[model samples]
Target: MKETVPLSVTESSEAEALFHFETGAPEAVRAALGLNATRIGDVVAVSMRNDPTRYWSKALGFGRTAAVTGELIAEVCAFYRAEGTPLAVLQLVASVLPEDWAEIRAREGITAGSSWVKLVAEVDEVVARAGAPDRRPMDGLRVAPVEPGDAGRWASVMMRAFGMPEEHYSGMAAATVTQPDWYPQAAWLGEELVGSATVYRFGETAQLFGAAVLPEARNRGGQTGLLVARARTAGELGCRLLVSETGAETDGGHNSSLHNMLRLGFRVAYERQNWVWQPAG
Candidate 1:
């Protein structure tokens, strides 16, 4: 008889820690933002890097966390302002805070951004689902681990896929793949690059991040191919679990990516609040 594998606990605190570790890692901090960009305090205040749009430039575990005070918010805002970031963000795990946390954030010039959902599943579960017969067939798509020479192409594809401006998109994609902790994958159809994704490995878990599919390639299995490729790659690298985050169902978008994640056997580990801070103009 075959043995059944046990599911690992997905504690909200652990997920929060994972988020911080990824954002504060030496390789990530250096590559995305640059040297000497973090201001450590009750929460880690990070300087904006290539993500000028305020999507990825935020203080990890900010006011939403325990022991974070108004004083700390002031300090964090000061650091971001010093770095010349036009806006600041505080990421709060919904499962970790009081119901009125949004009001607290509002009192400090912080407002809610997109609601984010964190999902996790066993590596084996993900790997097993990769070859399911019911899965969409990618007749001509090819996904492969990327080489340094492919940075520009990857960035270009991501720019078109994510609707990011050329300069910011290129800078983010190129710098991210160069990080020691990141492994990038590229999907192609014939001579054209169609998708991109990266797995950021740390300890026993790897976060599947930066996955994007070119507009022209939607509904053609490019993204699913990338997910399967990442799952296999993570397993080969000895990672025991896979974790990822996307916009929450309440965020008011179609959320096709979140649906795809569910099809891969990932479950919502928790939800988090994304708080945005716009400086008075």
Candidate 2:
């Protein structure tokens, strides 16, 4: 592991911006279609206009101290409730202060969720690691960007890989392919789809997410291939920074993706806390 340093102010701000751009992209698409997405400070609150997934209907805070005022949090939560969101999630960048956490805990119907570490790497470095001269592509595995017709298969593989419901991932895949600059890629082995990944570009930064691999393909190099393919594509698009997040290092061996990312030169830049609100009986 590389030596770690505390997050500087500029690094914190940039990471927060990437977080908002990445988490807010889908909601931003929904908002462009007249859904309820409003900005308060560096926070963006998106409601369940179409998809009712908690991931789709929540408030996203960017930067250090993204949500400083209790009033901002209350208003955003109220907006989601008014829009019929059963559960509201507040995902804040590592810069959030203790007072903000205290105010959030005081809110009715809210509970703390998982904390995640945001990882970042220079696109050049990832590209180099991915394109090492001795690194040969895994035999019997092929990866490529999804065509428009691959949406159904892509959705099926994603749902199965993540154990998500068909209804949820199907609709998500349908809507996602139509978003601007959303690149969904899939990996296959002898015509069987085994894994999937996605990259969303914001300015010079490319945020990677939604990487899923089937259980049968776990021991193989499918996951690493998918990561390298996505990173290369992002670099080809002129992005300089590659940002991603994974569950923090808590359970000893549960965060293999974090290990994979570190091997690809990604460093833990900061952490984010998740606060969730579900209506009481």
Candidate 3:
């Protein structure tokens, strides 16, 4: 068995370095996607960005191994000091044990929320299908490479689209500017930032990290434009596949956005259960 090491919060750099070494993955890339590390007892717990079901699922398929338990949950909650957020707990489950979802809910004192299963779509398959397109077109939606000067606008759109608090956006932006693997593009209406998406390449597979559209920008095709652009970019970069995940519960539990992906040639590769445990009574 691979040895597990405890993480020390005070020594963040050391913890991050050790995590990178153990995973043989880039710290900057993980950090950019909000994958932070927290040490609990003798175990190191790393929380991937919110909605990590797809990320963990892909990792498992790629032969990575990890175990999940209440201890991991406690450690993640403590790391974020998010004892009051149900969503945070949900994200922790998605990141830690996407495959063994039933085990998570069966644990004593755990109440599963209206969570989601991860869905994936293949671009080639969608293109081959002759039917209604998954994504809608934006008449004048323009996409441009993110500029350092637009950090504040980009941050605002992320917060609005993802429902993230100010602090999380701040951390995400700080990590984004320094990560080479992250390719950020902003959607604009005239000069107003309306949406944004980021692409992260892991080996030959490119993962779509964050895709958010401001509430005001919804139904305007901002998201669809972003997805299509990213898919084309990923293909041009020599990636054989492009992947992303969305909440199965969103859009009245049908995942309307996922349908858009299907229209664009992505398919559901797997369904993962998202589980969470609140503080025991």
Candidate 4:
């Protein structure tokens, strides 16, 4: 087994920004979702005006290229305001917060929010902990990279699994499969699709962007299967590490997703508190 290597925060942030920016080139779903991924210097500010949930609007990976000045924060807020986003989660690693963030945040209507636990697993660690890279059918489920014709079905399962019935979300999810840099995976219970997951490749790292299982498939190991499928692909492609994040276990609120990732060998790289902005009328 090859020894694990280092994964710098800079590379991980850059890769995440690229993944967020990926939606811009896919015009088909871009118009359908009213999605925009804007970059103010190194910061990536993304928004989806068509989704009522408003969870899609956030600015992340800021302050790497330069200090996050008050003006830069204002620019991000203005972008969200113009996009009609109800809220924006402004996220960055805690290590990079400027000394004057409190002043800037107070002036911009920003409020503190819960944190997300970023996780990382070396390829060798995954191989050892999750078993050898294998995507063959296990139990009653089979996992594989999404096929072109199956993108719509993948989107359907993804949106439904996430409890989102909005048609545009399916459109947004499906459009990601068409991107050359993204690797979307799906698990099938015989002929029926039960789960979906996606990984984005940027250089030596693979970002596990999203994954979910149908309610009916819960407790059936579908989540583990998705992890296995992604690990197998990342292994074959020489990816040094797999990166992902889930809502932190907070205030007695247990997160099953975090448990799944830890059980599969991913370790917490850091806990980053999210800053939320709600523009005042």
Candidate 5:
């Protein structure tokens, strides 16, 4: 059996390594976000890199982090200030830290008129099913191995599907394509490419990332089908589990589809919240 390491909250190089390995975010990005290394005990845990002030505040109990209802607000505020971006335009990826939410909100100082802060919860789950290898049996849907030259087109589809900027999609596609163990593929409906997903192998588990379906092609089972295909491919490569992140909030049309994934047998492993904060004007 694999030995379980105890969680520690200390500043250690090992903490930095674990943070980067788990998040897959660039080291420069980590530094830019001001990720601080903390050791919980024997295990290293890295604080969210997006805001240094909040990190210190939460760790020390002062500033925005002092308030129970304002942590999320504070964190978002600090993030925008550090990045020099408008609060409304920033997109935050959710992480599993509920105790810090209030401190984050207090830091942001969200008001009734200045800016809108939305608390989005994402459902994290693992794929329990595998894809069918007998492609000839399935009708109308064609799952093909993505070619090296098709990276650009695949990136385009991903950008549109996730509502992300072109740079992020392009960068991820380029990085994924060059990895020997990374498996990427596209889902075609008739002759049109509708969805795409990638599997990244990490030890005994494989993570499903970049799953997206074009707006015009959703609800035709494209996203779901692609997930199954990716899972099957991961299983074939000796991965025991496949995991993906989905939204839990239902305020938007996009989040409504999360119900479908849950109905398809994906259980919620945990819920993560994205905290936002903007500088005082």
Candidate 6:
């Protein structure tokens, strides 16, 4: 555990990271996907008209700048409703989840959803972790910066790794390759592009997002290699901290991503809930 980071810092780092990625699509792609976003109080919520998945259509980092009040939640729901986005995920830092969250969620037709374990690491600690023999498999793995022309290929490999439909999110993911302060990388196992990772730098923090490896490329040190790649990139850019999150481990279930992150010196800052909301009947 690196000295604990303030929840407000985690909140801002994460909120800006995801917001920039989700709404960073090109003009035509934005129109094609109906990508849009708005702020409710200090909370930023985004919606995708074409993609039905709630992951990209979510309100995050709320209640950190202010109290988690029912009115605030109502405004959040209204934003989604007006956009006609059928479902939404609301993420509030567990440490800041209002005391009456249960009642608020119940009244708003929100239900419990998966929790995410937020993690952070100092750049130096991660560089040390990456030097571990176990983390640096001797397989023919190499991580390199994604070229301008390779954005599509980079995004394709990442989405494929997660079994996501490429048509919905790949274009936007690729767009990040050119976004300022965004560093995207692809992992190559010999001649084939096997995985992808990215570091989104904001202020003094670098956010780790979109890291994944294909099924055929698993357990070969590609991910750890990618982590090292991004960590170094962030450090070179003068970032002091790296932030990331993955699904929390639950009873009878496990999240390999979470395990991998923990092994790389990323400590759990907190567990944040995903509150699901749908229109009332």
* Among all candidates shown, the one with the greatest TM-score: 6
Cα lDDT tens digits, model 6, 1-281, are 24888877777777888889988888777887788998778798988766755567889877666877888988898888888777888988766777888888888889988888889989888888888766547378888999999899899998899888888578889999999989998999888899999988988899998999998888787877888899999889999999998888889998888877778888988888888888877
Query: How good is model 2 by TM-score?
Result: 0.81
| lDDT tens per residue, model 2, 184-253 | 7899988888888888776677778678898988757777788898889888999887878788877555
Point out the worst 10-residue segment of candidate 1 by lDDT.
Answer: 1-10
Please give, for residues 1-281, the per-residue lDDT of candidate 1 as tens digits.
Answer: 22322122333223333344345444644465532245455355555544555554666644333555566666776677666677766765554445555565666677777778878877889889988888778868899988888988897787678777665446556766676667789999898888988887766777787789887777788888888889898898898888887888763558888888889988886677777876656
Weakest lDDT window of 10 consecutive positions for candidate 5: 5-14
Best by lDDT: 6
Off by over 4 Å in 5: 1-105, 108-139, 165-168, 249-257
Model 4 ranges off by over 4 Å: 1-28, 132-139
Of the candidates numbered 5 and 6, which has the greater lDDT value?
6
The residue pairs found clashing in candidate 4 are none
Candidate with the larger TM-score of 5 and 6? 6
The digit string of per-residue lDDT tens for model 5 on 1-281 reads 32221111111222232333333534554455444443222223334434323321122111211222343334434444554543322222133234654444454553221121221111122234233243223346767778887777776777667665554325445445555667888988777777777766655455556678887776666666776667667767876644455555645545644654554445454443333333577
Candidate 5 residue 79 C-alpha distance from true site, Å: 7.8
Pairs clashing in candidate 6? none
TM-scores across all candidates?
0.80, 0.81, 0.63, 0.89, 0.56, 0.94
User: What lDDT would each prediction earn against the true structure?
Assistant: 0.69, 0.69, 0.53, 0.77, 0.48, 0.84
Candidate order by lDDT, decreasing, is: 6, 4, 2, 1, 3, 5
Output the better candidate (2/4) by lDDT.
Answer: 4
Tens digit of per-residue lDDT, candidate 4, span 1-281: 43333334533544473445436335766676677877787677887777677677778777666776888888999998998877878887787788898898888999999888888888677767676445333567778889989989998998888888647677667877877667889988889988999887767787886689888777777888888778878888888788887889878788888887887778887788889998887
lDDT of 5: 0.48
What is the Å distance of residue 193 in model 5 from its true position?
2.2
